[model samples]
Target: MSEISREILSVGDLNRAIASSLEERFDAVWVSGEISNFKAYDSGHWYFSLKDEEGQIRCVMFRGRNGQVGFVPQSGDLVEVGASLGLYVPRGDIQLTIQTLRRAGMGGLYEAFLKLKARLAKEGLFDLERKREIPAHPRSIGIITSLQAAALKDVLSTLARRAPHIPIVIYPTLVQGPEAPSGIVAALKSAAKENAVDVILLVRGGGSIEDLWAFNDEQLAYAIAQSPIPIVSGVGHETDTTIADFVADLRAPTPTGAAELAAPRRDQMLQELAAIEQALSQRIHQRVEREAQTLDQFALRLSHALPNPERMREQIQHWQQRLKQAWLVRVDSWSRNQSHYAQQLEMLNPQRTLERGYAVVLNAKTGLQAVRNPDELNTHSAFEIRLADGVANVKFAELESRKS
Candidate 1:
């Protein structure tokens, strides 16, 4: 026999050899099995094993382009995995690297649901603390649901009854199926971008868990949690609890319940206002009556203190007389002092003396009072002789001074 050619393979060659063996021996195909020993890493990678009642095969759903599908897988879940059988180079162990997963009996969607819920819960998307409080008086309320949904009609009717003036902004969206989650998320994002609403109502009519699965999506839950405005989740009946409900600021049993929570009843508020007005009016009337009684008491006391009207009139007359006497006395004393001062002032007046037959002669040019002595007088100068009634301007032809 020809000596078998010894094949010395490098490490890469060994890995390729094992890879080729796995590729050829087990074709890339689909297998349905129950998930077992599912494990996820912090690096966003998944490792799990799928097994039947008697057999088991290791599998991995990597963090590749279809990583979002991994978000819904869980242990003990029945899943159909599409993968290629591969061998690990180190241990030369054969395993299936899962490219995709589907629900074994119910289809892949069910597995996807559980996976997304787990992922979102791990990220704190469903934390109550992360939720915001709905506005007590939202100016405009946005509704995210199908327009044809009965929930929309209920919401409209409730709002019309409660707060008709509040505006409503409706964004039509799918509430079911594979595309529902994305559609709902987009609707929420659009509402946020428009920013016309103070609060958003994510509502849907009563439905089965499958029908309301879109609201349970991890992406939808996160969107509700991350929304800047408060979200009121009203999905399904009162007994149903969805991820959106858990993450929303407020959860209503029905769409009408959401409308009621978002606004105050118009008639109720008006009644309250009317009650307040009536209370205020009653208080004012009481106050006025008390004041009027007080005024009446004051008038009665005044009347009693003066008993007879004639006596009161006499007292008023007496006071008036005393005031007149005091004022007259002051006026008389002021008049007498004024007269005495006037007489003294007249006695000191040179004009008064001149009126009593005295004359004042002054030199005209020098403007000096003329003296009796001739030597003190200037001859051939103009002079002013002031009399009581008139002043005479004269020229002195000769100085005639008399020594008196």
Candidate 2:
């Protein structure tokens, strides 16, 4: 060995030098690729890989900084990542430490999902006000899921165990695979057409993100959001959440949980019914007792105040005598008044005067009284003379005048 140059470098000094060099040269870098191996740790740290069609780079998202970013990073998600190139001191491996992440491919399904989510959120579709209350007692429950899924079996078993009496309509359809999205949409549409269910339960078993992808479809989310009936989403296990969960009226952690929530428990209902019946019985008994006491009081009063039949008869006879005496006095007064009025009416009767041989005359032609003046009578006119019960028609034969 010729001349060996020695430089003492501590681990901290080396890391500091590497970090400073990275900060100076690659402080603000924009890398665009699809997100992969995304992992959010409990320590509020994220570890992921950003990959393109050809290659990929490992990245880490620390909690302190990534928490500020607006969107969440998911596996297979295309995102634009801003990060610093740094070496992990222990491993001495260079990795991209992401500061911010945004969705990649400005014109892809991911972009559409974000855009629709934003639009729907702005329209208040995701608002609590738009959510409907789940029916406490569903008369009929509708289920939209795959016919052969384990989720269907779980839901049915839960419903059967919890609310066996409730009628159920199974609108079966594919919940996975290529056709699952359209199948689910059609199933929901068919269930709506029946219009028979009080509530709808859209459920599927727990699976990986790819397995639950159908529930994340935009069309499926919109359908659930626009469903006429209230929907309960139990798409996956407790840890997994999808867009359906947000849009559904209610979200259950599991299929069994969905069934339990969709309707009330039979035992609880029975207990409630028993309580109501007991209250009604108690009220009825109290009312009957009250009415019976009232009747007994009435009976006692009737027994104590029984009337004397002979005394009542004698009192009635006395009233009858008084009524007869009053009627005789009224009859005598009426007879006296009637006779006086008859005499007065006899004096004023025109027919009675006519019957006493008085006569009246009238001219026929102007229907006026016959006149003795010659100027007052026309020769062509007729006249009438009246006695008690007869009248005589007469023509004016000659004019007679009387000077007054």
Candidate 3:
């Protein structure tokens, strides 16, 4: 064999090379073990060693990351952490730089939570269109929660303050442990069957993921979705969410918030009613004024349209005077005509001619015929001569034929 090639390196250089290699090879990884030698500095940084019976690993969670851990870890607490392997150049020792931390079993629970959430979301349980609207003015309210839960007091007090007139129904049930999901479902069914409440509130106090895991049950989510009455879920704190929250008709940040949303405030409703009354009164007043104005205009038009009685009387008197003048002229003309005709009749009277002494001659043989020629009187023929009142018989003494 050829002489072995030799490369000499200082301790710091050696440790830097090892640290770089470990980081490049491992990336971030999760490891589980019981915590030991845990330490907290004033800077809020956490230093600890994770160990099991067979092996142990040194770990450090910086201040920036550990602040979000949500709890201070004690020695011998089982924890799982996501960390990158590295060698501390200063100490020249292997260690892990923790980026995340959680209780050992939380990882599995979180994974299940994500899986169920995805499946239910794909089935349209979380669709916005499927959600119902909470009644603005519910006649009654139902509460489904643990009787021992502190959240119950909060919701009750809030509803009482906002809408005391509304009736409240409580359906007590377990909010945790293995039996919580079924208990909640039973209470929901009872409330639905009774149908006494317009809205239902599903509430629980704040807790860790494990403490609140019962709300994540698949059956409870389905039950909430199937309820006919609108459900308002107020589970855990604002940051805490579960499957029931997604399936409920509405999600409130807190139990008090659910109560507030379920019932309308009495004082606020009164204000709205007052405003409506005022608007109606104003509209009625305006309508009446408009009608009164229209009536006044009609009255003015009627005064002009009606005929005057005084003018009618004057017209009648003028026609009467003209008629009287025509009648008098006709009467005078008729009386003059009658007087002229009477005078003409008197001039033509036959008795007046007889009184003038004219006499009628008649043949004496019949004593009724008048003689017109001298031949009727041959020698000694008798004839009657009649004056106005007497007749006398006479004979012709001498006959002379000289007159024609």
What local lDDT score does residue 66 receive in model 1, on the 0 to 100 scale? 45
Compared with the true structure, what per-residue lDDT tens digits does model 3 show for residues 54-127?
99989999999998999887665678899999999999879999999998743456778889999999999999
What TM-score quantifies how close candidate 3 is to the native fold? 0.56
RMSD of 1: 38.2
Cα lDDT of model 1 by residue, 299-360, tens digit:
56656787696776666557556755665676567557656765764465456777899987
Off by over 4 Å in 1: 1-129, 286-404
The per-candidate count of clashes, in order, stands at 4, 1, 1
Cα displacement (Å) at residue 276, model 1: 2.0
Query: What TM-score number comes out for model 1?
Result: 0.45
* TM-score winner, 1 or 3: 3
- TM-score quality measure for candidate 2: 0.49
Best TM-score goes to which candidate? 3
**Candidate 3 deviant stretches above 4 angstroms:** 1-106, 305-404
TM-score for each predicted model, relative to the true structure: 0.45, 0.49, 0.56
Candidate 1 vs candidate 2: the TM-score winner is: 2
Cα RMSD to native, each candidate? Answer: 38.2, 37.2, 55.6
